[model samples]
Target: MSRLAQFAVFGHPIAHSLSPQIHQAFAQQFGIALQYRTIDAAPDAFADAVRRFFAQEDGRGANVTLPHKHAAFALADERSQAATRAGTANVLTRLADGRLAAHNTDGAAMVRDLTDRHDLDLRGHDALLLGAGGAARAVAWSLFEAGVSTLTIVNRSPEAADALADAIGEPARVHTRYWDDLGHIGSFDLVVNATSAGTLGQSLTLPFSLIGSRAACYDLGYGPSAFGFLAWARAAGARYAHDGLGMLVEQAADAFQLWHGRRPDTGPVYQSLSTRSS
Candidate 1:
């Protein structure tokens, strides 16, 4: 048999990643043989690890997560519009000429998961975004693309949220508030948690008043990391609440399509993982 295509995901504290399982399932759907690994690399080692993976390990493509998304964006020789818009990249492809191309699927994934998977209508909805890191930037862009009327962003470090709003350059539609000011922000039709607080096992202790009676809440963390916000959302009476497992699978499908020129059906894969996660 010909050598299997090589791919991997790079992140810090990567032991909990499900990218390998997700991608392998996708590959099996198309009868494609490939190997996907998870590489744990701190911020300092991210670039070097990516370079070595592509150059020496015959890596055809890779996924980036957490603290490494920005580094992946910077390391790429070229970027897709999605990456440029988010100012970070979650997918990296190796070109025939040995150049690295970066892309961000987080935004598209979030949009698909919310609108398609969960039947959440984003158009004209007032949305509240928590956090301003890599995931938040991408999710913010997606929410706009999905037609959220206004977006309020809040973070522990207000400067980061402000910077993201500035980057979006939509002063009229995008706004920022301090994390402590969340209680005064009024209710929202949609609330998204892109913060690492949950991933780091910290509670945000957000106000229940932030959730409208018919609101939907989403956390951009999966498994145990997603339980905190999801629990809070349920207790706050959100009409719908979900973790990022669906988004993760959706984004991985996007990356898979980019790398393999085909899209695998996400339903079975999501159901399998959801079962395991639950």
Candidate 2:
């Protein structure tokens, strides 16, 4: 028995996450045995619980997800430029002196999954983003930075969408459209579903026609949750349609890199999960 590095994903309703399996695969690539688990902590107790987790001798990092990403950013002693730009943090690392450092890997996860995995060139592509929650806000800026020609954000709450667009800066490039106007917004090279509509098993009636002939559709949810959106994409004849599983593996690899200076090969891990879901 040797020393083990401990890490976990912190969020509410985390039972279904594939993070532990993904991180385990990453650690095995470097011959490093690690402990990773899911931590279900509400916003009220997130900061305190995280403090305790890192207090462990082997505590190395924690991947923040869902409703906790913004809270994780708030609790960190220092934040990386990525986290600051995204207005959220999904990865928390224990600094050498035992302080929490925050980084948002979600946006980079999306970029990597789209570009590296699918070879979709995000640069100069028009994108339509669904939802304006924490996850949406975190990735909105990243897409713009990735060189999206224009980003049209649509959400139930028009005000929330407007605020997020404003925060993403360059008002001219980032604009908000009402949910009802989704269909009328015309086509997009990239249609990204950032809404929780998929997770709740709610039937989504998206305007998949918005997917251009050569467009790609991406759901932020993995597995079954992502099926609704991806199915719509496939039916709409999208060039490529995918779930968030790749994003999960890539982001976990990013966190692993932050914790151990090792970036794992994500192809096999992603294929493993994809096969399981299929």
Candidate 3:
């Protein structure tokens, strides 16, 4: 019998990560025996921990979450175009020659969830992205690439928002909004909340005008963190509201495909996760 393939997700507070369960469901689909775990690696120890994980013979791949995606990007010997564009990587795989390959699936995951699952058309749509953190940055590029007519990123720090807008190129299609100016920004077809406020259990007091009767609200943070935003969006009369659960599963599916040649079906897994969460 072949030795079991090993994988894991690394984060500062990784105990609550659902990646192992998601990957286990994917593995069961292909009859692939694998052991997936979560590792709590401090910021200073992140690089070392990942290095050690991929250096193992049984190690196949790992996902990097929150606080460590940039570290994972730096640690890789090779990076995909997506990772290069995003300036961070959330997935890493060990090559046959012992080199580490890195890529970002966060953007693709969001795109899949929005377009494929939600049936939202990105072409010529106006989007409002909240926050300027790594997750927001990754999804911003993806939204632009998906043909969004305009993307206005709002953040607490004006400089950060401006920097992200500049990096997105296409100055005509991308703009920055100060957190205080959110109310004056008008409405958007999509409003994505990528702020850590969700995870921190803080409610965002977004401008009521930003959400039209038909606007869709997406909270990039999942699980308990998304509840506040979901409530806020509903109270604001958003037509649709969703958390990052779909993105999480979709992104994991992308990572699974990168590590293993076969892509696992995400429908059943997503349904299973949704049911369990509810």
Candidate 4:
């Protein structure tokens, strides 16, 4: 019998992750038999848990999610440029030398979905990014690199947004807006929701003026919870509103490529998940 290749996604509360299903679909495309699972590792146990998993002969790779991306970055022996810029890692693969290499695919995934799937031009476009967490940081640098003329980050904790903007080091181009001043901000071509509001079953209110009829609003969260932001965007008169399902599929595709050296088509899997959800 062939040895079963193994992979998993790690997080503090991982029971809800769709990663196993996504990876299974990707592997099936190439007739590769693999076993994927979710590992609920506490913050203090993350490092050891990851080390043991990769030490296993059958382990191929792993995905890290929420509250652990930064720890994964520290645990990696080598890191990708994306990971270096984001100061976080979400994908990990075992190297030939028995070391773990890390990569951050979140930014690339978001950019691809926005430009390729949505066909929204980022060149010289104004963008508003909500939240100042890891997800926000990962996409901020990528948005800037994609040629967004002005990027304003708004957060409940203004200090967090300020620190992120400072780290990007282009104060002239990037700015931070206080949460209370969201009403005064002008409409942006694109508004990205990177906050944890959805996870908390909460929604944020922004001035109607901040969402032009042609604006696109995207939330970096998925599932039923993500509906909150999408609903708000639609109510606020956004022309295009969407959740993060596409981003999830695209990022997982990148992770699969890093581990297996083969990129699977994600369209079918994305449609399948969407159909199931609907």
Candidate 2's error at 53, in angstroms? 0.7
Which predicted model would earn the best lDDT?
1
Number of clashes in every candidate structure? 0, 0, 0, 0
Top of the candidates by TM-score: 1
Selected candidate, larger lDDT, 1 vs 2: 1
Report the C-alpha lDDT of model 1 over 113-200, residue by residue, as the tens digit. 9889998889999999998988899999889878999999998999999999998889899999888888787999999999899888
lDDT of 2 by residue, 1-278 (tens): 77677889998889988899888888888888788999899889988889888895457899988788888899899999888876788999998998889998888899899999988889999999999987787789889989999999999989989889887778888998999987788999999999999887798897666989899889988888898888899999899998888888888888888888877899999998888888
Off by over 4 Å in 1: none
lDDT of 2: 0.87
Q: How many backbone collisions does model 2 have?
A: 0
Give the lDDT ranking, best first.
Answer: 1, 4, 3, 2
TM-score of each: 0.97, 0.94, 0.97, 0.96
Choose 1 or 3, whichever is better by lDDT: 1
Candidate 2: C-alpha RMSD to true structure equals 1.7
- Pairs in clash, predicted candidate 2: none
lDDT of 4 by residue, 1-278 (tens): 98788899999888999999999999999998899999999999999999889895457799999879999999999999889878899999998888889999998899898888789888988899999888888999999999999999999999989998999999999999899998888889889999988877787777778896588999988997689888889988999998899999999999999888999998899999989997
At residue 247, give the lDDT of candidate 1.
96
RMSD of each candidate?
A: 1.1, 1.7, 1.2, 1.4
lDDT of 3 at 263: 98
Candidate 1 TM-score over all chains jointly = 0.97
